[model samples]
Target: MSEKNQRAHDLRMYFTGFGLAVTLTALSFLTAILQPFGPVGLFATLAVLAIAQVVVHFRFFLHIDLSRQAREDLQLILFTGLLIAIMVAGTIWILGDLMTRMM
Candidate 1:
């Protein structure tokens, strides 16, 4: 494709991802506020939506696809995710332990 067409395509993909992220966020908020489900269910729904938004951001905004050119970026993304998970888990563990000690 021509340079102009490629640019347009990329812009459209970015916008599409943005739209999807917004929609998912709205749905998550609505589900939580409306109390459409119990607490556990709401948590599950929110988690799913959050994960989907992450995927949209990765694909559209970060342009991190499975192509050969994106391999290094993909590895970086994976490493970032691992770091985040570890931090989150550690925080939760520490907070829970503190709460238990307080009790």
Candidate 2:
């Protein structure tokens, strides 16, 4: 494709990603406020939307696809996510332990 066409294609991808992110955010907030699904249901809905938003951000904004070239980037992202999860879990565990001791 020509440079012009490529640019347009890239622009479209960015716009699409932006739209999806915005929609997901709005839905999450709305779910929280409306609580149509009750507390537990709202939590599940928000979790799903959050995951979808992550995917859209990676695929569109980050330009990371399933292509061979994107594999390394994808792996890096997954590793980072794993590290974050571990840290969060450790923090929660420590906090819980502290709270129990206090009680």
Candidate 3:
């Protein structure tokens, strides 16, 4: 594609991402305020929206796709996700242990 076309495409993608992010954020806040769902359902809905927002951010803003050129970036993100999961799990485990010991 020509330079102009490529620029236009990028601009369109950025706007689309922005719209999606805003919509997701608004829905999350609305869900919290409106309390449309029960406690468990509310959390689940928010979690799903949050994950979708992350995906949109990665695909649009970060330009991290499944293409060969983006493989390294994908690996980095996956590794970061793994480390965060481990840390969260460990913290929860420690807290649970403390609670059990206290009881």
Candidate 4:
């Protein structure tokens, strides 16, 4: 393909991915408002959808692949996950303890 055609094709793919992400995000918000499922189910579904959207954005927009730097990318993702978990757990623990003490 010509260079211009290739660039246009890439742009189209990017826009398609972006449209999907936006649709998924809007659906998430709609679900939150409608509450078609219970709170737990709704939240779970939303979380999964959001994670999927993140993956889609990474794959399509960021163009990070498992070719060479896969190991480093995976390590970074894992470390970020660990940090998020620790922060969430610590917040819950400290808040729960504080509430108990206050009571």
Candidate 5:
């Protein structure tokens, strides 16, 4: 295909991805409005939906895939996840210990 055609195709794909992301975000907001369930249940559902939206945005908008640079991408994602886990765990542990000492 010509360069112009390729650019147009990419633009179309980007718009499609944007539309899907917007739809998912709207749905997530609507789901957040449900009040029949308890706060815990609502919060859990909202959290799950928000995470799903994030993954969708990453996969479609960012065009990240395992098919290309699979190992490197996987390693990067794993390392990032591990770092986040360590940070969160350490913060919680230290805060909990401090709270115990204070009481």
Candidate 6:
């Protein structure tokens, strides 16, 4: 495609991503305020929305994809996610243990 077309395509993708992100966020907040679901269902709904938001960010904002060219980027993101999960879990575990000891 021509340079102009490519730029337009990129801009469209960005706007689409932004719209999806905003929609997902709005849905999350609406769900929280409306309480349409029970406690467990509400948590599940929020979780799904959060995951979809991540996907939009990866696809549009970060331009990460499943193509061979994007494999390295995908790996880097997965590794970072893993590290973050580990750190969060470890912190939670330590806090839980401390709380239990105090009780």
Best by lDDT: 6
- For model 2, the stretches where C-alpha displacement exceeds 4 angstroms are none
TM-scores, all models, native as reference = 0.85, 0.87, 0.91, 0.75, 0.70, 0.86
Model 1 — TM-score against the truth? 0.85
TM-score of 2: 0.87
TM-score-superior candidate, 4 or 5: 4
Query: What lDDT tens digits, residue by residue, belong to model 1 across residues 28-103?
Result: 9899899888999999999999999989898988888999999998998899889999999999999999999999
Q: What's the ranking of the predictions by TM-score, best on top?
A: 3, 2, 6, 1, 4, 5
Query: How close to the true structure is residue 34 of candidate 3, measured as C-alpha lDDT?
Result: 98
Candidate 6 error regions (>4 Å): none
| Candidate 3: tens digits of C-alpha lDDT, residues 1-103 | 9999999999999999999999999999999999989899899999999999999999989889999999998999999999999999999999999999999
What tens-digit string does per-residue lDDT give for candidate 5 at 1-103? 9999999987987787788778877876777676656788778877887777777776677766678666677678779989999999999999999999999
Question: Tens digits of per-residue lDDT for model 6 on 27-71?
Answer: 999999999998999999999999999999999999999999999
- Candidate 6: the clashing residue pairs are none
The residue pairs that clash in candidate 4, if any, are: none
Which pairs, if any, clash in model 1? none
Q: Decide which is better by TM-score, 4 or 6.
A: 6
Q: What is candidate 4's CA lDDT for residue 54?
A: 91
The residue-by-residue lDDT of candidate 2 on 1-103, one tens digit each, is: 9999999998999999999999999999999988899888988999899999999998999889889998998899999999999999999999999999999
lDDT of each: 0.92, 0.94, 0.96, 0.89, 0.79, 0.97
Better of 3 and 6 by lDDT: 6
Model 5 residue runs over 4 Å out of place are 1-5, 96-103
**Runs in model 4 with CA error above 4 Å?**
none
Cα error, candidate 1, residue 91 (Å): 2.7
